[model samples]
Target chain A: MKQFQYVRPTEAGLAINALLKDSGAKFVAGGTNLLDLMKRGIEAPERLVDINRLPLKEITKNDQGFNIGALTLNSSLAEHKDIRKDLPLLSQALLAGASAQLRNMATVGGNLLQRTRCPYFYDTSMPCNKRLPGSGCGALKGFNRMHAIFGASEHCIAVNPSDMNVALSALDAIVQLSGPKGKRNIPIQDFHRLPGDRPELDSVIGKNELITGISIPTSALKHVHYLKIRDRSSYAFALVSVAAALDLEGTTIRWASLAMGGVAHKPWRLTEVETFLAGQQISAGLFQEAGTLAMRGAKAYEHNEFKLKLAPLSIGHALSIASGLVKA
Target chain B: MAKEKTSKASRRNFLKQSTLITVAAMAPPVALKAAEEQWDERLASAIENVPLNIEVNGSVHQAKIDPRVTLLDFLREHLQLTGTKKGCDYGQCGACTVHVDGQRINSCLSLAVMNDGRKVTTIEGLADGAELHPMQAAFIKHDGLQCGYCTPGQIMSAVACIREGHADSDEEIREFMSGNICRCGAYPNIVAAIREVKGGSKV
Candidate 1:
């Protein structure tokens, strides 16, 4: 940990002002990810404006749906009565992420603001555009197994490392952000950006802005499921994960939204597959076709060709579970 | 008239008492302001030999500390509470687990001022005076720890897990306890210890 000034502001307004004023200061909420980056010298700030005391820990129901405060811990949101009942996919996704203790301490705001968990990003010796703003990407040619297959630019190849974001995208969750510019609501899909020419722009958020809450519509998808594929059962990020929700009328699918993780720079929506699945009879072959369409635009590195294949399987499994083709 | 006069005196006394209570209630804020003034008087970014008024394990200590010091370091180095191990100080490991305000959290990840005015319960604070916490006793009986570096954190997490109702079975316990990495491979015994409390098994 580097030497820095610290302030514990009970008010969000004051915290934001402090963040905007300081030339090199960052907001600390939960301190799960940022603190780690700081310790490893990946993220350094001259000051830290702590916003943990702000009342951003509520899960309330509005006319639109559920509004979850940004400071709400991941474990609390995972076990929330509304999230568990109304958004089972989100609950399942949150459960699959990290360990119990981290989940207990990690906030929803921090999770949304989480950076890539690429081993290359963690090591400062390596070249990463997200870390260093393009000294050239080391993962492009070396240790590229876990790199993304979709939305990869020449500068960076790492994947978006959030399982919760995948589910939130599937449910069409909206992120509420606050800053010196006041407040704004962004759709979850548009919240995370792709690795375009500028891979450093991971999201449409400014440095001084803080995520205040997330809103998910109270939905009856008929069936919802979250599937995470990884080397281990727990304590590991997903290799290929899918969050799928489907509206089934008898044996045929009516409406569906599918989002895939660990395969793209952001949570990917398989809209082509969703369009194909609507009014089609659910079967293994149809599921395979949908999965195939989901990975149509994927560009794989030398080592991560397996992910291109594994990502489809991840989606197929999630589709089956979500459509009730198989028992949950 | 005498009774009315007595009543007036009693009301005056009650008002004075209320004023005193108000000041007492606002003491922490006032004390915090005074402390701030002292910090400003020194007028140095590098405040050598700064004192940290940390309340830990139901006690307070004004320990001299480096301005760059972490709460975990302050506990392990200043207070000699070695129960909080420093495994993967990057917050990857839960070896530095402690309770700040009745909830389990990673101490290494938090700064000392972040916890000021908040109650801290480290692994050393888990047990009553001379009496081991039920989780600690269960771990000892079940042989849940080997080498024991990660034991304190594991025990603290176990306490939280049970209280959070995550200790339903071995699988659940294993899932919930994934943060506390035990290199000694004492997982089976650790599960047994948690089950002894959650499943109500006789150890």
Candidate 2:
């Protein structure tokens, strides 16, 4: 790792100012991904502004909904009583990611800004547009079993490797950011961007901005499920994961929110399937239809054709589990 | 325009004379060679070190540390607490697991400067002076280790797993302890040890 200066700022304003003054400065909160990237020489920041001292580790509730501070550890958030009771999907998703040790060190903001687990991006020798702009994407033709199947441009095919983001997308979370200008709230769906021509930019956050907290409206959806399918039962990135939450009225689906991970540059929201499931009776045939509708525009690469089949099956399985038709 | 031109010419002349004077001052060949040989090392050591006041294993330590030094290295190298191992050096492996503020975390991913004024408990701190911790005793009783390379991390993570209430069942223990990889296939024994400890068996 390259030697760098470290600053611990107690105030959010000071952290923002430090980042604004130094273009090469990065905010280090729970340096799980950043340090790993630094060790690999994929990220070499000249300065790291430590935001752990900032007053942003609260998990509070207000009129809007539950407010989770950006610095809250993933382990704490997953085990929090209110979170487990109110938003079990988020807890399930958080526990399904990385491992017990990583969840303890990872922060909410860090998880939101984590880089892809693409092998090409990690290898400095390989050409990855996400790692270096204008560099050809090696995953497009190389071993791409984990590449994106949705919202992928020719320049990059890497998927966002965050399970928490998928649950946040389904729950309609709001990201609170503090920047040079002021505070702003960005909806979670718009927070992460697709890899168009600009594969380098991960989030819509500005260079000098720091994430303060995230808010999720108290969900009325009683049945929620996060199903992550990976090579191992744990300690691995998802091959295809589904976050399904449904509002049901007896045997009928009142509303639904669905998102797929490991298949898109961002969490792939199944809006069409969501719409199709609304006001419909819950049945095996209806779930099959919804799953087929969810895979309408999914395109697969050479090694990831299994995802095309696995994605729908996982979605169906998740829906089945959420609807209480099948036990998880 | 005329004043600017004269000023630019004088600045150039001053720069040339200063370069000549600097070279003349370094005319001693031996002195220049000595300075050149030690310049890189000197400058590297001169890089600012952050003041860290960390409490490790119930002992307070005050030291100046390089901001890039990880908590794992700070424990193993600086403090001579080699009981904590560094398997992958990345967060992928749990060999560098340690307790920060009573919560288990990957020390390899944590910077020494980040944990200033915080308490860290490594594998070295697990046992009492002459008595082994319950987890350690259980590991020995169950023969949980083969090569013993990943024992420190596994023990730390297992202690945390039980404390975090994720050791209620065999599957939960396995899932929660998935971060620590024992390549020697001591998993079944490790799980048995964890279960025995979780069951509150006296060693």
Candidate 3:
């Protein structure tokens, strides 16, 4: 880890000002991923504006639905009564992530902004376009079992390693930001970006911006499920994970929301599959078709060809669990 | 209240003035030119240490620490509280687990400066004078450790797991305690110990 200046500003405005004043400054909430990156020398920020002192740890509800402060710990959010009762999918997703200790330390906003778990990106010795732009992507041809299968460009093929973001995308969550310009809101689907030519840019957030909170709309899709398949049963990154939410009218599906993780740079929302499943009866055949439609444009790397097969199966399994066709 | 406010204001003023003088004295002409280009980097590298005040266990200590030093190093190296082991030094392994405000966290991934004015309970603070904590006693009774390298972290995480209500069943205990890795394969004994503690069997 490199030496840096630490500033703990009590107000979000002051924190933003500090970040804007220092070009190399970063806003650290939980320091779970940032400190890991720093230890690996993947990131070397000169100034860290600790945003933990800011008043952003509330979890409230209103007509718009739930408003979760950005600094709320993952453990608190996952175990919050309102979240567990109203949004069980998000709770399950949070629980399925890292571990209990990590969940205790990681904040909601920090989890949303976490970097990919690509081995190439962590190794400074390797040529990673995400870590160093213009440097070649080692995962493109090298060992890429964990690379993205969707929304991947020639420059980078890293996948977002967040289970919470997958559930947030399915729940139609909105991210609120505070910066020098003012406050703004971005839908959770648009919060994270695909690996384009500029793989260095992770999200749409400005350099000086600080995430204030996230808002999830009151949803009708009550039957929600988050299923993560990993190498190990726990404490490991997902090979392919799915978040499925369904609204049923009798035997037919009224509405559906679906997203997949560990398959794209961002949570890959299966909108086409959701559209196909609506107005359709819940059955094994329909679930199979939805899974097939979800993987239409997915392209796989050399070592990650198994993901092409595993992704659709996981999607079908998630849909089955969400529709109550199969017990989770 | 007036006295505290005045002292705080004076401290702030003193910090500002001293920082300016140090930057002026240490920064060379070439460094100042580079600082003009990238001020944040130059300004940060110019300073050597940052002020940190934290409460560990029951003791409060104020000191100047390198911003790069992790809480694990601050405990093991500076404070001489080596009970908190550093296994991976990254967030992957939970060998440096500690209780920050009664919640378990990995200290290796947390910077020492980030914990200013926060209460931290490491493995060294788990014992009650000469008496062992219930979890520690259970681990000993069940022979839960082999190499004993990962015991402190495992014990810390186990205590938190029970307190957080995630130790109701064997499977739940296994899932919740997944962060702490014991390479000696004493998992069965460890689970037995946690189950005993969860069942209120202190002996």
Candidate 4:
């Protein structure tokens, strides 16, 4: 690992100020991702602002919903009573990700802010737009199997690899952030951005911003499912995954939100599919049609043509599971 | 969760006197403690060498280390407690799995400073003198290891699995133990060992 300076502030305000004011520092919450990147030489922060000492480790009950402090470990979130009871999908997604040991230490904030796992992005030898602007994305034509198909820009095609964020997207979660100025809330759906012009700016979060908490509002989605299709059942990134939550009256769908992972710059929200599935009877054919609509605008490269097929099937299966038409 | 956090004063009692070695040990006896202390006083103040007063099993230790150092590294390197392995430095792997404050966590992922004044039960601390932890004993009895690199991680994760009520059934054990990967393909024996231990009592 590259040698660097480290700071551990005792208070949350001091930590945020240190993070925002320091031009050469990056916040180290759980250090699961940051430390890994640092060791791999992917992220070289001249000064590591260790925010672990900050009081960002609380899991509390708020009037709006469960106000999970940013530094709250993933295990705490998964096992939280309110989350398990109300937002089981989030819990399930968290459980499906990484391992028990990681979940216990990986914080909710770091999980959301974790970088993409694209082969090119990870391998320093390869060219990746996400890693270096104007360097070109090697995944576009080389080993593009895992690259994004929808809402992708020519600059980058690396897919968002967060299963928790996928569920959070379907649940319409909100992020609370503190910075040099003050604090602001950003909706989960709007938190991440497409690699439109600058693939570097993965999220709307400013460099100075430190995630404080995440609020997940209550919703009447009768069913929720996080369907991950990967090579292995354990510790594997998704080949194509879908998180769908639905509200059903009798057999017809009243409300729905679908987010596709391993196939987009962000956890993709299928508004077109949601609009099509509304007021429609829940059926395999209808779900298939909605899935088709969801992946309609997908653009496949030389290697990721399978996603054109896998994306729709996965989404359809997730919608079926979320609508109570299939088993988990 | 209030019950989860033990008070600092209560935790201090857990550390043994032996761990409280004098700060005199930090310097050469010949060199004056005041010597060169003025040169980097600012740098030293920037990073305080926090004392980790923790109890591992029945024994307590006070580790004076860089607060940024992780508990996993502190145990493996400074303390020379290597029973807990470091597989994927990232929390993704359970190689450095251990019970901190009575809960399982990826030691490599947590800063040692964060665990100050907490009870830490590592694999080395799990056994009673010469006796192995039930999970460790069961692994040996069932031949649940091959290369043996991942055994420590698997065993630690298994203990947490049973404790968390995730080892209720064969399928549950398989799903729950998915967190700990055994590339040696001794999963069947590992499952059998965990089942044997859990079925014994207090499952």
Candidate 5:
């Protein structure tokens, strides 16, 4: 790793200013992903503003639901009584993502800002548009079994490798940020961007902004499931994961929220399928139709063509588990 | 005879001067603390070093280190605590697992300066003098290690797993201990060791 200066800022404003002052500076909380990238020489920040001292480690209740501080560790969030009871999907997803040690070190804000695990992006020798703008995409035609199946452009085909982000999208979570302009709340869907011509940019967050917390509104949807399909049963990234939640009135679905991971540049929220499932009776045929509807615009690459078959099956299976028709 | 003696004297001087220069340049400034009361200016000005006040095991260490060194390197290279192994260096393998503020984390992923003011417990601190920790004893009794490269991390993680209440069953122990990879395939034995330790009740 390259030599760099480290600064610990106790206040949010100071941390933001420290990052804004240096164009090559990065705010490091857990250093799980950032340090890994630095070790690989994929990222080299001249200065690191350690924001672990900032007062953003609380999980406070609000009129809406809950506002989780940015520095709240993933393990703490997963084991929180309220989160385990009310937002079990989030807890399950958080636990399902990394190991116990990683969850203990990773923070809520750091998880959202984690980079993709695309092999091309990590290897500096390879030409990746996400790593270096117009360098050319290596995974577009190369071994792309883990490439994006949705919201992908000709420039990039990398997917967001976060299990927590998929659950947040399904829960209607809002990202709270404080920047030079002021404080603002961005919905989870708008926070992460599709890999368009600007594949280098991961999120809509500004260079000077600090993620304060995440605000999740209360929901009537109690039945929830976060189904992560991977090569192994644990400690591996999702191949095609689904975060499903439903508000059921007896056998009929009153409301629903669904999102997918490992198949898109961002959390692919199934709004159309969500709308279709509302007011529909829960049945095998209905869920099968919903699964088909969810795959309306999904496009697959050469190595990931199996996802076309697996994605629909996962959707149906996840919905079945979330609706209590099948045990997860 | 005079010319040969003169060249030999110059060679002796060159050797002495180079040895002194190497020691001044390469060794940590803490090594020179006993020899001089004042800090070395030439060594301090070569590279920027951050002041780190970290509590490791049970002792507090105050030193100036390059900001780039990881907590794993600090423990192994600086503190001379080589019990914690560095497997992948990346967070993928858990050979560098250590407890920071009571929670286990991959030391390789953490910077030493970032751990300022934090209490860290490595494998070296697990045993109490001659007495071994329950987890360490269980590992030996159950033959949980073959190569033993990932033992420290596995034992550390196992201790935290039981404390966190995730070691109730063999399945839970396996899932929680999945982070530490034993390339020799000692997972079944490791799980057996953890189960035996948990059966005793309380970590």
Candidate 6:
């Protein structure tokens, strides 16, 4: 790893200002992903403003719902009684990610900002537009088993590798940010950006801005499920995961929210499917239609053409389990 | 604290001088080597090292080091605690697992300077003087290792798994202890060891 200056700031403004002062500076919360990228020479920051000392590690409940600090470790949030009881889907997705040790070190905000697991991005020898803008996308013509199926452009085809983001999208969580200009809140669906011409920009977060916390509104959707299909049963990234939450009234669905992972540049929210499932009775035929609607415009590459079939099945499976119609 | 820092600084200086002298004595008669050393020293002096005071295995160590030095390297290279093995170093493998503030984390991914005032417990700290920890003894009794390369990480993770109450069953232990990968395929025995420790007593 390249040598760099390290600064631990106790105040959020100071950390933000330090990053603003140097264009090559970055904020290190958990260092789970940043350090790995640094060691591999994929990323080289001149200064690292350590934000671990900042006062941002809190998980509080309000009338609006829950406000989780950005520095809240993934393990703590997953095991919290309130989270497990109220938002089991989020807890399940968190547990399905990485492993015990990684969950201990990874922060909620860091998880939101984790880079794609595209092999082309990691291999500096290859040309990856996401890693180096205008360098060209190697995944488009090379091996791209894990490339995006939606919201992908000609510049890049990498998919976002985050289970937590998928669950957040289904839960309608809001991300709170603090910057030099003050504070703002962005809905979870808009937090991650699609890979367009500027593939280097992963999100709408501006320079000198820091994610302070996340706000999730109270929900009456008690039935929730996170189904992840991976290469292994444990400690592996998802091949195609589904986050499904439904509010059921007798045998009919009152409301529904669905999201997918390992298929797009961001969490693929199924608004059409959610609309189609609402006010409808739960049945195998209905779920099959919802699955078909969920994969309407999904385009798959050569190596990942199996996802075209696998994604719809995962959506149906997740909804069946979430609606209590079938056992997970 | 002041006296301890002073003494450590002096000892560091002595070691630096001795290493330099030994290297010079062993080198061949090459004038270009001396010029290269001067250039290296000039470049080294340009980079500032960050000061860190980390407590590991109940010992407080104060030193100035490169900011890129990870907690795993600091423990194994500087403190000579070789039990914490480095596997894959990218946080994919858990061979460098250690307890930071009573929580199991991958030390390889955590920078040493980030652990300024935190307590770190490595495999060396698990024993009570000469006696082995129950988890350690369990691994030995069950023959839970073949190459023994990932043993320290497995033991550390296993202790944490039981403490976190994730070792209630064989399936639960396997899922929670998935972080530590034993390339030699000692998982069944590793699970048995963890089950014995979990069934026997508190971790």
DockQ of each: 0.26, 0.45, 0.40, 0.26, 0.35, 0.41
> Runs in model 4 with CA error above 4 Å?
A60-63, B1-53, B64-69, B201-203
Highest-DockQ candidate:
2
lDDT of 2 by residue, A290-315 (tens): 88888887899999999988999999
For model 5, name the residue pairs that clash.
none
As a TM-score, model 3 comes out at 0.92
User: Candidate 2 or 6, higher TM-score?
Assistant: 2
Candidate 3 local lDDT, B1-203, one digit each (tens) = 24534543454455556555655776488548644666443444446578899999899989987788899999999999999999999888788999999999999989998999999998889999989999999999999999998999999999999999999999999999999999998999999999999999656
lDDT, candidate 6, A66-148, per-residue tens: 99999999999999999999999999999999999999999999999999999999999999999989999999988988778
Clash pairs for candidate 3: none
lDDT of 6: 0.90
Chain B TM-scores, listed for every candidate in order, come to 0.72, 0.82, 0.78, 0.74, 0.77, 0.79
Fnat per predicted structure, each in turn: 0.63, 0.81, 0.81, 0.53, 0.79, 0.84
Tens-digit lDDT string for candidate 2 (B100-188): 99989999999998999999999889999989999999999999999898999999999999999999999999999999998998999
Which consecutive 10 residues in model 4 chain A have the weakest lDDT in total? Answer: A1-10
lDDT of each: 0.83, 0.90, 0.90, 0.80, 0.90, 0.90
Task: Chain A only: list TM-scores of all candidates.
Answer: 0.98, 0.99, 0.99, 0.96, 0.99, 0.99
Residue-pair clashes per prediction, in order, are 0, 0, 0, 0, 0, 0
Return whichever of 2 and 3 wins on DockQ.
Answer: 2
Give me the candidate number with maximum TM-score.
2
C-alpha RMSD for every candidate: 12.1, 5.3, 6.9, 8.3, 8.8, 6.9
Relative to the real complex, the DockQ score for model 4 comes to 0.26
Candidate 3 vs candidate 6: which has greater DockQ? 6
Ranking by DockQ: 2, 6, 3, 5, 4, 1
